[model samples]
Target chain A: MRLRLTPRDPSYFDLFAAQASYLVVGANLLAEILGADRATRKDINRRMAEAEHAADDATHTIMRRLNQTFVTPFDRDDIYNLASSLDDCMDFMDEAADLIVLYKVDELPARVSDQVQVLQRAAELTAEAMPRLRSMDSLQEYWVEVNRLENQADKTHRKLLAQMFDEITDPILLLKLKEIVEKLEDAADAFEKVANSIETIALKES
Target chain B: MRLRLTPRDPSYFDLFAAQASYLVVGANLLAEILGADRATRKDINRRMAEAEHAADDATHTIMRRLNQTFVTPFDRDDIYNLASSLDDCMDFMDEAADLIVLYKVDELPARVSDQVQVLQRAAELTAEAMPRLRSMDSLQEYWVEVNRLENQADKTHRKLLAQMFDEITDPILLLKLKEIVEKLEDAADAFEKVANSIETIALKES
Candidate 1:
């Protein structure tokens, strides 16, 4: 029997890259929120919300294209997973920022900034790697490095939690800080998930 | 153009229901852990881990079948998402149990049990709904009710947080309890996600 194959559309890669770029914007916004004074947090949060919305649109575009195109660059499931994972990263980041504003957290441990830094590096790596998905080449390092970064974030998370319990006295303040830190840690975890989805696609195609 | 259709396999629905069954076991195990004394905590956690492993196996079977089968009951992405979301619910439950063990949390607030009850009900609803996915009929109520249960879980989560800050004086204990509660909340959230995936599939297929 003869097999029929539809022509591949490369625009999916563009959309993926665009979505990853939103993660970068989101990471930067998170880092900024960590450093910004209380006076600026509201504005920073608004910007983060905007970034999250932009990422959502990018995800919708990918999904819409998947429905319209008979053939995708990779498995349709991989595309959907990648898009959702990227969206999750932004969502957690936005949630973290919102928590800070909602909780009116005045001070954060330095380790929170450290976690955001890990997120920034992972976001950069993700943005760089999304375009490489078209060929599925040199993408293994992207995921491996992301896994390492997530591990680093995990260590920082544990240390921060331990320190908070050991040093923090006020239960209310501890609650606020803990929620923010966990969300940042979750963002890091979401980034690793995105990388894992990309790696899965690579393995399946290769 | 002539469209060729492949027959849908019903085994997938079986696997999904089996996975949901593990969730029921897990929810009960979580409730047991919450109510059990320290002496039985280890045993309960072990049981939870086992349930999680079983759910993982079910998820793997679904994925393997998805790779081998040409036609599925619904979109392949929806199948994968539903399976993963169910697996995630178990993972979070296991994590919460493990956290209780790891933190050696002496006593939990009564509301923790309330959250687990919501999870139990949602799990039951999910198990009942997975079989109906084959026909995509009467599944709407399953997801809508799950969403309501998740909202209920959210209120309990916030109330527990408030109580932790208000009544719990020890910073260390508060931190431990908060993490466990959040994980439980996350499990509830994952269940709703599974329901949402099912609902999406139902809408698309109908």
Candidate 2:
């Protein structure tokens, strides 16, 4: 066992970990909003906006540090990409939450909960994985698990799409539900992107 | 007005031009299919697939060359981004054409024709812009115009969405048209991304 003596700024890991933590907040909020009443959902959406803003701030901090700092723990491009993808995860989840409130849909399909659960799991994995970037140990499991979860999310999304088309009768309601589900799917894709970025970074380091 | 010898690969521009030209083929096919009967639309979609395949090959050529070459005309990441965005333009347009055929919609709202027309013009502008990367001359107009066109397309899309909800009563038909329009809108966004990438490369060179 050895301590890293290189002058790499160790705080980039902390920054990334901070940024990823918001994903968990945003995802959990998304899960909460789905089970909420209309008034409660509006309140949860307000909280989601705050969480998104916090995530955005965390990202800006990383970018600012990147701009000023000469050296980084990884390739600057990879850092930028990882940060952007993390922000995307928050943005997509926030959009899903916002749309649910804006569309005033009384209920989402049961499969949507399945979609949100995948996001929550992916977010937790990402949060856990970020701190490990410095050590770069056991990262293979994190990315591989996230990838598997994303595939599951994708299957759920297609089924939900087909099911909605078959069962939903009102075009306007159908439009609202379709858009909301798609946003959740986008969030899932964004999570996969983050995992892929991590995999590239880990492979390069190794 | 003098050029000293630099060992930058000249063919990257040609590769990009080939890719952008497919967007024109794609955008034009999208426009043509909007006017064609179902039989002809199917044929146009077949041709669109061929154009998309050509575009994919062009992107692969660039990627292969990028991996092999030491010096690029611009930043390697910028080149990668520009190529990816160009590919996105083709993919989104191809998807729109495919969905139009798959959905078997008899008619699209007239504004959708306006959307395709915007894509056609943006594609032409992009094809024209590719050659100018060498000099980085007069690129301001290309990106600026593409941004303006994207804004217009966004407005058109929102209006179209509102109108569809207000007018269309059939849920199935609404889903088909909505998905198709969103794909067209996504194509417009992808074209704007290409322009944005070019803008970055030009700014760095300037």
Candidate 3:
């Protein structure tokens, strides 16, 4: 088989990596928000908001590049989807953090941390994979790993939901915690969507 | 501007129209579920499951056609995003319906029907727009109207959430209703996303 090559800018990869890095920042801040005292959660929420804005900027840059360039390293739609999905992951994390503050919840379940860990790991994998997208080489492992993490997150989410309904008695507190957990699960789902988009690109390019 | 045309299949438009029609079916079923007695809610939920499944098939068909066709009526990525977004709207509606059943939510706020009405209108506009995709003409009204409906849905959603937190005292019931409301809001958000995708396609294609 012959190798097919196309003229494309490497900067798209740089922008994608930059965007994935924001997910890491957002996830860590989410973890901080979960573990921080009520006094400190406000500051963490502010930082998460800033991270989400930065991610949004990266997404816009990618979109601008997509419009100006005729030939891309991969499918234009895949690039758009990947960038949008990464931004979505950050948005969900921000939403989860914002809800914590908005609802004024003082306590969280231990499983919240478990889900954050999955997010952090997935973000790391995503950051590592974005640069390798230019070559489309050995990228299958990235998506596979991300998929596995998402599955683990699903299980953690189910367990947390069950525990929340079965154990929590305070009505307002239960409502707040359930929203937070659901947002975290949404972030996890968004990460898997990013992975799926990458897998689609790899399949078409390879 | 020069008129540039690519050879494309028209069947993809049919599939999109078919998918949008499912949203109508799902929306109507949701309205029924919201208004019906508990015994009838079960039957409505079953019908919703079927609509969701049918939407999934339409989505898969679009994807398969995307892979097989060379040139498309619009950007291939737009095609994928439009199909996926339509499917997502249905999925969120299905989730909301299932949650009502899963949580055994007895009474829904009046505003829930308001949001469903918005969804129904948006679905009708989307179905009407899909056929016009072939010429990419007179499609602007569809997205514009859908956007207006989405804004109305947002207002209804906010009002419902405030009402729930302000008046609902039962913890478990509060949690259940909040989840249901959030999912409906998400479906509205998804519909707006579909509209946004269509707007993008119109701008690019026209």
TM-score of each: 0.63, 0.67, 0.66
In candidate 2, position A157 carries an lDDT of 97
Using DockQ as the measure, the top candidate is 3
Clashing pairs in 2: none
For every prediction, compared with the true complex, DockQ reads 0.14, 0.15, 0.20
Native-referenced Cα lDDT, model 2? 0.88
Error of 3 at A16 (Å): 4.3
Question: Between the candidate structures 1 and 2, which one is better when assessed by DockQ?
Answer: 2
Could you tell me the C-alpha RMSD of candidate 3 in Å? 8.6
Highest-lDDT candidate: 2
State the lDDT of candidate 2 residue by residue for A54-163, as single tens digits. Answer: 77777767776765666888999899999999999999998788778766788889999999999999999999999899899899999999999999999999999999
What is the Å distance of residue B14 in model 1 from its true position?
6.7
Model 3: residue A158 alpha-carbon error in angstroms: 5.6
* TM-score for the A chain of candidate 1: 0.93
Compose the digit string of candidate 3's lDDT tens values, residues A174-200: 777888998999999999999988877
**Candidate 1 clash pair list:** none
Better of 1 and 3 by lDDT: 1
Least well predicted 10-residue stretch by lDDT in candidate 3 chain B: B1-10
lDDT of 1 by residue, B1-206 (tens): 21111124438878888889889888989888887888799888877877877788778678767766678878888888999999999999998998887666778899998999999899999988877877777988888999999999999999999988999877668768888999999999999999889888878876
